[model samples]
Target: MNDRESKSKILWTLFKSMFMLSACTFGGGFVIVSLMKKKFVEELNWIEEEEMLDITAITQSSPGPLPVNASVIIGYRMCGITGSIVAVLGTIIPPMVIISIISLFYTEFRTNKYIAIALQVMRAGVAAVIFDVVIKLAQNVLKTKRALYISMMIVAFIATYLFGVSAMLIILVCLGIGIIDLIINLKRIERSAE
Candidate 1:
């Protein structure tokens, strides 16, 4: 196949994958992230698990919706600017359509006893999924076995959970520490090379 044909195939696959994931996913971005990891990292072998972890961190830290941010990064990684656009379109379309329909029936949906029950039940499942994501993320961080990273993770959790510290503040502090660590590691490498 020609280069254009291959690229087109990939783009089509990317769109379909994102659309399906977005449509089926519930419990927000963290839930979809697990599904994305399974699909992209485990199933497709498109990206490594480590890359997915990095993507999760980056997406969580950046502004706006997590899934959209993730799609832009993942799409750009796969197929540049065009891929990002396609991915965002796929990710947003299902939710947009669903929300539009839901809004149309807002009063009926809000008042329906059966619908209310269903939504309440769904909250339990959503909580479980979010918990699972948290565990997986924590495990990934622990797997590195880096003292500083492990310490930072623990401290950040403590600060947020116990002290009610701002999550944004913790993220900023971590980001600064990460930058300093990177520079220090680079300098060490240069010194060793000399």
Candidate 2:
């Protein structure tokens, strides 16, 4: 196919993939992230695994919803602003449609025993999915074998889970540290090249 045609096809594919993933996904952004890693990283080989992890970290640290942040990044990477809009629309539309439909049945659905039971079951499933995400992400971080990072992760987990320390605080501190590390590394490289 011609360049324009090929690009169009790829955009369409990205749109369709995001739409389908959003439609079927029940948990939330983390689940969508895992699936995206599987699809774009493992299956399609469109992005590297480390890059996907970086994308996930960036999306999570940002202010917006994870899926939206992810869509924006992925789409921009693939095509540009047009692709980003298409991707965000695809990621959002499914939930909007589902919510619209559910709103029509709000009263009945609220009173439905089966739905309550199903929701309880779904809570367990969601927990499992979240746990899986945690494990995978932790493993990825731990693999780098940086004692400082490993210690920080452990301390951060303890602070958040046990002591109720604010996550935003942790993220901000880590962000500062990362910047410092980058600056130091660059200076070291320059010194070595002298």
Candidate 3:
């Protein structure tokens, strides 16, 4: 395909994927990341799993909701600004429409016990999905050094949950440590090569 045509196709795919994610992801944006992985990595083959996690991390650290930001970055990577616009629009539209509709009859919906139960069930499912995503990400991190990454992950979890440390601080500290470790590893490899 020509450049323009390929770009158009990529934009359309991003739009459709984001729309589906927005519509189907019930609990929150984290669940959408799992859906994005299935659509982008498994189905479209647009990005690798590691790239998705990196994009997710960036999205989390930046302003705005995680899924929308992720879609923007992914779309931009695939096409450009236009792709980002399409992806953002698609991600926003479904939730906006759904929320509008729900708000119209929210009182009635709120009173429905079956609906409430179903929502609770969905919450559990979403939690499981999020946990799965965490495990997958941890596994990827562990590939570099199983013990080290596991230790870092544990420390991060403890710092955030138990010690009540800000997650942003933990992430920044971890990022710095990771960079330093990479530099050291690179030096070691260079020395070995020499």
RMSD of each: 1.3, 1.2, 2.3
The CA lDDT of each predicted structure is: 0.93, 0.90, 0.88
Off by over 4 Å in 1: none
Best by lDDT: 1
lDDT of 3 at 163: 91
Candidate 1 residue-wise lDDT at 45: 96
Clashes of 3: 0
Candidate 3: Cα lDDT at 46: 89
- Order of models, best lDDT first: 1, 2, 3
Candidate that would win on TM-score? 2
lDDT of 2 by residue, 138-173 (tens): 998899998878888898899999999998898998
lDDT of 3 at 103: 100
| Order by TM-score, highest first | 2, 1, 3
Structure candidate 2, residue pairs in collision: none
- Please give, for residues 31-86, the per-residue lDDT of candidate 3 as tens digits: 89888988999998989888988898888778789889998898898877888899
lDDT per residue, candidate 1, 102-122, as tens digits?
Answer: 999999999999999999998
- lDDT at position 59, candidate 3: 85
